[model samples]
Target chain A: MKSFLSLLIAFVAINTELFAAEAGMPQLDPTYWASQAFWLILVFTILYISISKFYLPKIKDNLDNRENKIKEDLENANKFKEESEAKLKEYDLILENAKKEVLKIHFESKSTLDKDIQSKKESMEKEIEKEILKAQKEISELKKNSISSIQIISGSIVSNIIENISGDKLNESSIKATVEDVSKKNMNKFL
Target chain B: MQQFTVQRIGPEINIVGVDLSFTNASLFMVISAAVIMLFLFLGSKEKKVIPNKLQLIAEMSYTFVAKMISDTAGSKARPYFPFIFSLFMFVLFCNMVGMLPYSFTVTSHIIVTLIMALFIFIAVTIIGFIKHGFKYLSIFVPSGVPAVLLPLITIIEIISYLSRPVSLSVRLFANMMAGHTMLKVFGGFVVSLGILGGWLPLSFSVALTGLEILVAFLQAYVFAILTCIYLNDALNLHH
Candidate 1:
C-alpha cells in the first residue's frame, strides 16, 4: 500500500514539473490532480467490477477443478485399499475354517475306526463261547450213554467169568437180558 | 454563411458514419496477441531440457507458474499451473507491448481487466460449489462469532466476497491506465520539445518506463497469485 502511494506521488511530481516546463508559460491547472484522481478512481472501479464478475471466477474455477480431481482420485484409492484389505481378511478366515474342518474330519474318522474294531472283537468272543458250550453238551450226552452201558456190561461180564471158571451156575433170564442189552449197546457203538 | 474550416489529418478509417472504431485499443490487443504467439512458438520446439530461444521463455514461464502455484496454493494446487502460467504470459506480453511508442495498453483499459477478473471470480465460485455442495455457504459464516452477530458479520463477509472481482479489476486497470496516460503526456512533451529541453522529459520518461515495467510484472503476479488464493478458498473453503 505504501509503495503504491509512493509511486502515485512520484508520478505526480515528475509529471507536474514536465508539464510545467513544456508549457513554457504558467503553472499546470490546480484542478489537474483532482481530475486525474477522479478518472483513476473511475477506471479502477470499472475494472475491479468486471474482473470480479467475469475473468477471476473462470480462472478460479479452473484451479479448483484440478484440485477436486486430485482429491477424488485419492478417495478412490483409499476405497480400493479398504476393499482389498477386507478381501484379504475374508481369505484368511476361509483358510482357517478350512483347516479346522479338516482336523474335525480326521478325528471323527479315527473314533469310528476304534468303535468298529471293539464291536468286531466282542462278536468273535461270543462265537467262540457258543462253540465251546456246544462241544461240552455233546461230551456230556456221550458220557450219559457210556455210563448206562457200563452198568449192564459189568454185571454180565462178571457172571460169565465166574461160570466159565467154576462151571457151576447156569445163566439167569435177567442176566441174559442185561448181557444182550450190553452187547447190543456195544455193537451199536462199534457200528 | 462563412463555411471555411480546415480539417487536418483525417482518420485512417471511417465506416457508416459510426467511425468503425477499431481504435488504438484493438490495434494493441492484436499486436500483443501476435507478439505473444510469435515469441512462444519461436521460443520452444518439442521442449528441451536444455532450452533453445523460444524454449527458454516457455520453460521460464512454466517454472514461474509452477513455483507460484506450489508456493501460494501448495502442491495441491499444482494442476492450475498451465492456466495461471498462460495468464502471466499474456498479461506480461500485453504490458511490454504497451510500452512501445504509439502502442495502446489493452490491459490498461477497464474492459479487458474486468473480463479477466470476472472470469476468475466465476471460476472460483464454481469450484467452491462443486467441491463443497451447499456446505460452501458455510464459508460466508465466520467460525468464531456470537449468534447475535451472525447476521451482521455474514452480510459483511458476503459483500467482501462479492467485491473480489471489482477490487482485482480496479487494481490492474488503475495502475496500467494511469501509468500509460502519464507516459503519453510526457512522451508528447519529448516530441514537441524538438530535441532541445527534451532531455528533462526524456530522462523522466525513461525512469517512468523502467518503473512501469516493474509495475507490469507486479500487477500480473498479483492477479495470478490472487487467483491461486481464490482456488485455495474453493478447495478448502475454510470458515
Candidate 2:
C-alpha cells in the first residue's frame, strides 16, 4: 500500500516535469534527450518484461492448446475409424459365413428331396407292372373257360338231333368217339 | 513545428550535469509502452480457441514479428525476438500517435532513434566479438580481394561498418520529421488560403496524410528489419 502511493506520487511528479519542459525543436535541444532516454529505458524495460512474462506465455499457451486439441481429435477420429472398419469387416465375414451355411442347407435339402422322389417313382412303377401282369393272366383264363363251355354245348346239340331222326338211341361211347374224331379233323380250320 | 517540441512536465532534476527532467517526449514514450502492454495483455487474457477480434490481432502481431525475425535474421536470432518486437511496436505506436493532430512524434527526434540504434549497434558488435573473438576482424577483410587492394577495401569496410547506427537512426528520424513537417506546411496553407483556394492544399494535405501514415508503418518496419540484419551479421558473421 505504501509502495503504491509512492508509485502514484512518482507518476505525478514525472508527468508534471514533462509538462514543465520547454517546447522547441527536439533535434536542436540536447537538454531533454537525457530525460527522454531515462524514461524510455524505464518504460521500455517494464514493457519488455511485462510482454515477455505475462503476454507471450498466454498466447503461446492458447496456440499450443489449439494444436494439441486438433492433434488429439485427429487421433481419436483415426482410432474410431479403424474400429468401425474392423467391425465392418467382421460383419462382412459373418454374412459370408451365413450365406455359405444357407447354401449348404439348401443343397442338402434339395438332394434329400430328389432321392425321396426317385424312390417313390420306382415303387409306384413296380406296383403298376404287377397289376398289369395279373390282369393279363385273368383275361386269358376267362377266354379259355368261355371256349370250353361253347364246345361242350355244341356236342350235346348234335347228339340230340341224331336220336330224333333214327328213333333209336345211339351208344354213348360211339357217339363220344365220333364227336372226338370230328373235332380233331376240323380243329385247324375252326380254331 | 510545434509537434516536435519536448516540454517538461515536472520539476527539473540535474544529476551530475545531465538534464533528467521528465518531458512530453518521455510521457508519450511511456504512453506508447503502456498502450502496447494493455493491448497485448487484454488481447491474450481470454485465449479462446476461436479467437475474438482482440485475440486475433494479438496473434497476428505475434506471428508477424516472429516471421520478420526469422526472415531477416534466420532462426538463430530467435533469442532477440522480444527486443525486436518491442522496438517495432514502440516505434509504430509513436509514429501513429504522432499522426493524431497535436500529438508529439517521438520518432521524429534524432535522440530517441539514435539511442535505440546505438544500443543495437553496440549489442551486435559485442556479440560479434564475444562469439568470434579477434577472428571477427575478418569481417572487414573481404574474400577474393587482390593483395594490393586489400588495405583499401578493409578501410572502406571499417568506415561503412561504423556508420550502421547513424544510417539506421537517421533513416527513421528524417523520414518522420520530414513527412510531418510537410503535412503541417500543407495544412497551414489550407487554413491561410480562402475556401476556393484552400481546396488544392487541403487535398494535397489529405493525400500526404495518407502517405505519411504508410511511411510511419514503413519506417518502423525498416528500423526493425535493419536491426535484424545487423543481428544476423553479428551472429553469423556473413561476409
Interface RMSD of the candidates, in order: 13.3, 8.1
TM-score of each: 0.50, 0.74
User: List-wise, what DockQ does each model earn?
Assistant: 0.01, 0.27
- Tens-place lDDT per residue, model 1, A70-92, is 78989999999999999999999
The Cα error of candidate 1 at residue B49, in Å, is 3.4
Per-model root-mean-square deviation over C-alphas: 17.2, 11.7
DockQ of 1: 0.01
* Off by more than 4 A, model 1: A1-191, B1-24, B146-148, B189-197
- Which regions in candidate 2 have their CA more than 4 angstroms from the true location? A1-24, A108-191, B14-17
* Model 1 alpha-carbon miss at residue A133, Å: 99
Candidate 1 local lDDT, residue B232: 86
lDDT by residue (tens digit), candidate 2, A87-111: 9999999999999999999999999
